[model samples]
Target: MKNIVNKTFELFSELEHCNNDQQKWKIEEMDGIMREMSEDELNSVLSARMLNKICQMIEEKKMSMENAILLLKCIGYCTMLKRIRVYCFNDSLVNKRFKTLIVDEYKKKEKKNEKLLVDFCECYISLSIYFPSGLLSVCVPCLQKVAFQKEENEEAQNEVEMALMALSNVKNSEVKKELSLNEITDIIEYHQEHHNLTHLAYQSAWQFLIFRFNMERSLEEVIVNELHFVREAARELEELRECVDWKRREKKKGEKEMKEVLIIGRWLDVIVHFFLSCQLWNEEFFGLIGGIESAFQKAKGEHRGICKECISSFTNIERNRAVTIEDLLKGRAVDAVVKEFQTQTLNNEMTYECLTFLMRVLRRLKEEKDEMGEEKINTIKKKLFEKMEEEGHEDIAISFYEILHFFKRRYDNGLSLDISDYFVNVRENG
Candidate 1:
């Protein structure tokens, strides 16, 4: 077994100078060796030697970029070899192996051997063209080292570009396969760790997963799932914000980090708006919104100068366009709020902001007024006030008063006022 392993290494070593005819001979020899070796023997030998062999060919300048790519493709297709290859190349546990190999190679060379390092980096990048999924796993650390060296090697930069292109193509292919949510999460986690230096790819992967998930379910359903991710992202933002705040006591670096936190906060706000627009109100959901609002309020109080105006504009637009409890009860929207308290709480808001939104929705409903029974409207109004008192928001009482007054003045003078008051009394009695 040892003899066969040594002979295999020798053949790999000779690949650098091997011509087309020699390459054919080497291929045949490798095939014959495979025919004789047990599966276990083959696995052991390949696992121990394949990366070293590839690196040797690279160092010797015998491996063409094209052939390096072909070899990885071949390894990918080899059913018996696929697991080992993925283990070595894609598994995060083996990251240290690639890192060690690159660092050891660098240590063996003189300072002026920068060209050799650049060539090896280029070759490593080429390997990604064949196994793009694994490329980010294996090559990113090495690329980061190169980037850190601050060497102005255009070839090295192009190699990173090419690897990214290949990764993009692989992602497109994966998306078309209708991968499950778990699979998408796995891909995201992998890229998140491996491509930390290039945030665009990670962000793109996240957005793609979200977009695809949204296509299969209503926005309401998507919002429920999004809650989990949103909370996780928000926690990270809070940590980042703390870090920035601490840094602000010393330097200006905090500003850039704060911008990242703000961006994440804005995304969370957008997600909240989506949930609110569907009238999918729940205690937990409201708690999340209240938490964000509180954070924004604190930031504003601290004079942190967050984009409050923009957030207000977005929140108002969402509320005005949002489906109301009445719309849900009438079965007039995609998502229906079925809970009695939820429906009531949604309607009793009286803040200038809330009133403005309510007026807009009420105007639209009146314009499209299909004769809903006065009794049903009264029942809904009663439920709303009862829930408001139950929820301890007495401010809603005044809002209801103003809404009733508006209806009287706008429609039939005093005629509508009596009908509206009748429902209000029924609500109070109930």
Candidate 2:
């Protein structure tokens, strides 16, 4: 720890006096040191003084492509740590200078340094989380151009992925005011039709578009647009269904597949938020209810929770609505929720999500008592109560009580609950 601090100080001093070539070498050394440090060590080393110097190095005009990439990497690492990010954000001069550098780079003619472009996108993304206003204008246009380039190579695909991600992080209303609804439609259309795009890139593209849609459009406008959001969401879910091997019911095996599954899970999560906010409960327009139900039956891990939540939201239609609940209940949705609740250990954020999903199902079953047989409903109630009684789930059961009672007393079931209970549980257990 002492050695890392001393080394950081020495590098800081060397960077101030070094020429361009020596600065490049020292920047590489700094990147290596940062990469090797644990999160604690990195946090400790990124004092306000150290962070300021790093930002200064990034603003250097004569930096080599290699050194630029290295410095971006260093800045990217700094932006990830909350303390360092706060330091960067609070220092207004440093923040504006860094943003100027990024925007100016984006304004230049397309460069040959593909790696530097990718690194810039990634660094901009990390910084945008804390400095969205400063970074969004350059990031949105720069990333959008790359995302639409549709280049058919891995590096291009990687560029598109980072671009999509950088765009997704942006929330500045200044940029949003300039966005055309057609642009949002174009990206979603691209995602739906482009079969060759990598899963990461595909997911990233929709995530950004979805953010823009949810923020810019009201529920009424979403309907007036001819249910574009619902249709596209359904299309993505159907594609996800085709991608999965349903009969196997096997966990997606490899790091790559696991990551894909998790991405799909997160994608479903954002879709859930979109649907809930829009309150687009018409199963007829919200097509592909069956696909969501079928996939939840076989989904494992975090995927299961989101799938179940999707099922919960889709079925949670108003009684007077034109569509019958029976239309969405293609199969035993309650059974999947109960089985997941019974089998899921009292760990993971998924447990809380699944539990909230279960609460919704329980309320729905009680309302339309005829939809599910009394026997099956009682069976589900029994399994849920039994699981809650288990020693490990006591905390969850306690947190579950208020929402459970709210749904029963004819209150607004849409009232939010603290979803952090599971994380708190994990910390205590850890």
The most accurate candidate by TM-score is 2
Note the Cα lDDT for every prediction shown. 0.41, 0.53
Tens digits of per-residue lDDT for model 2 on 1-430?
4576568667767775677889878877876666545446666765556555555655665444456555655655433321133344445444555565666666678674444445565665645445455466555655676677667788877666656655555533445546534554566566556654666566666556555655665533544255465555566666665565544434334434444445556566555545444543444542545545556765655344445565555444323243333443443443454455555443434444456554454455465556767665565455544544553445645555555434434443453354332221111111
Best prediction by lDDT: 2
lDDT by residue (tens digit), candidate 1, 320-355: 334344532342111111111122432332122333
Q: List ranges where model 2 is wrong by over 4 Å.
A: 1-65, 68-96, 103-122, 130-135, 171-174, 191-196, 218-253, 281-328, 344-355, 364-430
Off by over 4 Å in 1: 1-183, 188-205, 218-227, 240-253, 269-283, 301-427
User: How many residue-pair clashes does candidate 2 contain?
Assistant: 0
Model 1 C-alpha lDDT versus the unseen true structure: 0.41
